[model samples]
Target: MSTRRAFAAACLAACLAACLPWYSVSAQDVRANGQKQPPVSSRGRLPVTGCAGQPISDIIVITQPPFTERLPTRLEWVRRTVRKTHANTRDEVVRRFLLMKIGEACNQIQRAESERILRAQPFLVDARIRVFDDEAGGVRLEVETRDDFSMIFEPTVQSKSPLVRGMRFGDSNLGGSATLAAINWRDGRAYNDVLGVELENYAFGRGRNEFRLSAQRHRFGQDMRLEFVRPYYTDLQRYAWIGSLGGTREPIEFRRGDLPRNALTVRREFANVGAVTRVGPVGRLRLVGASLTREVQRTDEQSLLLTREGVIADTTDVAVPTFRPQRVVRVNALLGVRAIRFVQVQGFDALTGAQDVRVGMQLGLVAGRSILVRQARDRDHFVAANLYGAYGGTRSFVGLQAVTEGRYDRDAKAWDNFVTSGRLAWYFRPAVRQTTVVESEWSAGRDMRVPFQLSLADREGGVMGHRNSRQAGARRLVFRAEQRLVVPTRLNIADVGFAGFAEAGRLWAEQSVPYSISTPWRGAVGVSVLAAVPPRSRRLWRVDFALPVSADPQRRFEVRFSSIDRSRVFWNEPRDVQAGRERTAPSSLFTWP
Candidate 1:
C-alpha cells in the first residue's frame, strides 16, 4: 500500500476505535472465520511498567484542546498563532521524542513512557497514545496531545501565614518545547522580598539533553546556577552525564538572639559532574564528583540583653565560629539491581499481582576530601555509604534504605563523626482498590546529611501536621500507617476516590533541643480525596486535609489542601520493556517529575 493510503486507512480505523468502548479491545481473540488476532501477552503491562511494540506502518498526530487564555477569542487566537509559530515543540520535536519510528515496530513501552514524559512538560497538559490497525497489516501509532496555556501572569497576596505577599509572571512553555522561563518576586513586612528568574530547556538535543539557568536575589543574599545534561551519551546506549555549576550567598539563623542582626553570612560555590551507566543486565552504576568552596562573613550588633537600663544591653555567652574560608572535593557512587513483573490489567489502571517476582536493590558510596584543595580539619576525607531494597506487586510494595557516614582521623586512628539515616516502608492492598501503607524513618549522627533529620513538622515535607517547626534527631524514629480507599470511579477527579489516614512520628537527638521532641509520639489523623491520575500522577490528587491529633501549646498546625506526586525510583531495571520500551533513564534530581 502507498504511504498516504496506509495513513488514511489507519485514520479510519482510529475513528472506529475511538467510538468503541475502551474495554472492548482489552483482550484479543481469533475470529470464527479463522482470522488470527494479535497475540496478547498474559503478563501485565501497566503504563508505569513499560510498553510492547507492534510494527508500525504509519504514524498519526492528533492535537486535542488547547489551554487558551481567557481573553477574547480573537486575541487568544492571535496569541496562540504567534506562540505556535515559534514553537520548538513542533511535529518535528514530537517525532524526536518518540522511541518508535515510522518504519520501526510500535513499542507500547516507549509509547507510554513518551506519553508520561510529555505530560511532565510544562507546556503540555495531556498526551495519549493509541494504536490502530493499518491497511498493510502493520500498526499505526496515534499520539493525541493538548497544549497547556504557555503564558501565565500570577499576582498573589497570601495572608494564610503572616500576611505574606508574592507574584510570579512567566511562560512555562517557552518556544513551544519543554523550555521554561519566568520571573518571580515576593516580599513581606521584614523586607523579606525575593526576586528570581529562571530559564530551562528540557528538550535540548531532541530531549536527550537539558540546559538550565537561574538567578535569585534574596533579602539576605543571592544565588545562581548554570547546568547542562547529556542524558544518554554512550555507544552502549547505557551511559549519561551531567555538569552543573552553582553558588549561594545566604544567612543562617541561630536559636539565640545574642548573635545580632546578620551576624553571620555564608557564601558557597560548587561545580559538579556526574555520569551513570548500566553495568550488566539488571545492575547500574553512577559516579559524581564536585569541587566546593565556602566562606563566612560576620558582623556584630547589640546583644539583646540589658542589665536594667533601657539602653541596649549585653550578656556575653554566645560565641561565633572564627570566620574562615574552606575548599573541598566531593564524590558519590551508586550501584543497583532491579526486577519487576507486569500482570495483565483487566480494567482501567487496575493492578493485580499474580504471584511474580518483583524486587529492587541499590547501594551507594560518598566521599569528601579537602586535602588536595585546602589543609582544613573539616575537609579531612569522609566517606558515606547507603543501601536500599524493595519489593512491589499489584497489591503490595515494601522498601527500605539505610545510610551511614564517617571520617577516619589519622591522629584518632579510628572512624569518628559518624552519622546515620534509615527508612522502611510496606504497603498492602487487601481488597480491590484498597491499600494500607506502613512506614518508618530515622536519622542521626555526629554529622548527618540533610535528609537524615526526622521530620515530624508539617513543613518537613509531604507528611502532614498542624505546625511548621523543623526538628532534628541524632537518632530519631517515626512510625506511620495509612489506609487508602479506591472508589470505583475513573477520570481526572476522585479516581481512587478517598483515603483516611493516621500518622505518628518523633524527633530526638543525642542532645535534646527545646521543643524539638516530645516523650510521646506526635500523631495525627486526616482524610483526602484522590484523583484518577494517569500513571504519572500515581492516581493521587489534593491532600484535602491534615489535622493534629490533639491540641498543643504551639499552634504549629500545618495544613495543605493540594498535593502533587513526583515519584523517585531508587533502583530501576535498565531494560525498558514490558514490551519495546526505551532503556529507562534515572532522573538527575528526583524520579519522574
Candidate 2:
C-alpha cells in the first residue's frame, strides 16, 4: 500500500483503540463554605480527610512579578518580511485588556473571562495564565501572552465584473500605546465612493478611559461619529459613563439585485449617553438616553415591492400600478435599560486557554417615540427586549439567544409586532479530535418582511447540504445534527489530515418553497480534509466533498471549502482560537473600553 493508505490504516486502528468511553471522573467539587460535599457514584469521602478542626484555606489572587516573554517565532519573521514591515504589541498594551488585577480574591471564572477578553484583542494571539501555590496560603497566578503582527494594510479587489471594492491601512498598536487608527475606502460605481478614517485610543496615559473619532465622505453626503468612555474614572470602575454622536446618510436596498435603482435613502443625526453601575458582584445595569433626527426618502417601484413569488399581471394582461413616492422627516427620543449577569460553572477548559466556565446573559429594554411623526407615522412608538447567553466547556458547548421588538402606531391606535428570533446550539466531543453538534434556529412574527426575515439555510458551505435556500420567510425553523471524525496526526502531510462527516438538517417555513426540508430533509454524507496552515499557530484550512441524498440536481456531489470545521461556532475568525477546540459563539459587535 502507498504511504497515505498505510497511514490511514494506522489511524483507524489507533482511533478504534482510543474510542471507548474515556470519561473517568476525578476531583470532586470544592465549595468555599468549608463544607465537604459527597463524592460521585454514592462513594463517600474518607472520614476525617484532613487534620480535625483545621479550616479550609480561602483562595486569593497574587501576581508573580517579573514575567517571562517569548520572542516572536521565525514564522512571524517570515510574515513580516513578506509584508515589508514589522510590528510588536507591547506588554502594557496587553495589560489594558485584562479584567483581573492583583490583590483580588481568586475567581476561576473571572480568570477565564480575563483570558478570553485578552484573546479578543486583534493584536494578541492568546493569553496563558497558570495558578500556583503561594507560600502565604493564597493562590498566585503567572501570566504570559503571545502577540500577533499588529500592523496591516489591506486592499480588497474584485476580478471580472464587481460593484464594490476598498483598501485599508491600519495599526492595532501605535507606539506601544494600544491605539488603533485606520484609513479606508469603499468605492461603489453608482452610490458614490467613500473615503473614511477612524481613530481609537484604548486608554490614554493615567486615565482608564477611551475615546474614538471617525469621519467619512460619501460624495453626496458626509458623516461623522465620535465616542467617549470613562470606565474606572466614574467611580473606581464601579460606574461608567459613555457618550456618542453620529450623523450619516445611508441607503437601504429593496431587492437582491435591484440596488441603486430601487432603494430608500435615510439621513440620521443622533446623540447618545449612557450611565452604568455595578449590580452586586457579577451583574451590571445601565440606562441610556438617545435623541435623533431622521429623514427617509421613499420609492415607488412595483418590481421592487413584489412578493416572494414576484408580481403578477392582471387578468387582462395589464401590469400592476405602482404607488406614489412619499417622504418623511422626524425627530425621535429613545430610552434604554439593560442588565447583564455572568454565571460560571466549574467544569472544563475549552476555548480561552483557561480552566473555568463562563456563561453570560443579558436583558435589555428600549422605548422610543418620534415626536414629529405625529399622525402619519407607523413607527411612532417602539419597544424591544433582547436576551443573549452562551457557554463553552472542554467537552461540550451550548448557546441560547433571543430578541423581540414591537411598535405602537398612534395613527392606527394599534400595536404591531416586529419580529422575534431565537437560536439554540449544543455540541459534544465523542472522542479525541472528534465533534458532534446539534443546533436549531426559530424565527417568527407577523412583520417578517424581506431584508429582515430569517435565512433558511447556509449556502456559504454545504454543511447543511441544501442547494437552494435563497428565499426568505416570515416564519422559519431550521435544525441540523452533524458529526466529524478526525484523522490521526502522525499520518499527515505538512500537518494535514482528512476526516469523514455526515450532516442533515430540515427547514420549515410558511411558504410552499423548494427550500423546505419537509420534502427531503436535506441530508448529506461527506468526506473532507483538514490541515493546519502554518506561519500562524494551529490555523486550519478545510475542503469538503459531499454527496446529497436529495433529488435537487444542484445538490449532487459537490466541493466546499472553509477555514475551520463546519461544526464549530467560534464567531470570531477561526484563527482567534486554537484548532479542534470548542468555544462559545462570540458577540463581536460590542467591545469594552
Candidate 1 per-residue lDDT, tens place, 430-515, comes to 77767776777665544311112233442432246634433433345666677766566323212456777777766555532212
Tens digit of per-residue lDDT, candidate 2, span 75-111: 3444445234433444445555555555566666555
- Model 2 regions more than 4 Å off: 1-84, 98-116, 129-142, 149-237, 240-242, 245-271, 283-357, 360-362, 368-379, 389-392, 448-470, 481-593
lDDT of each: 0.48, 0.44
Query: Residue 249: error of model 1 in Å?
Result: 2.2
Which ten contiguous residues of candidate 1 have the minimum total lDDT?
576-585
List TM-scores for all candidates, in order: 0.65, 0.57
RMSD to truth, every model = 13.6, 15.8
| Candidate 2 TM-score, true structure as reference | 0.57
Whole-model lDDT, model 2: 0.44
Relative to the true structure, candidate 1 reaches a TM of: 0.65
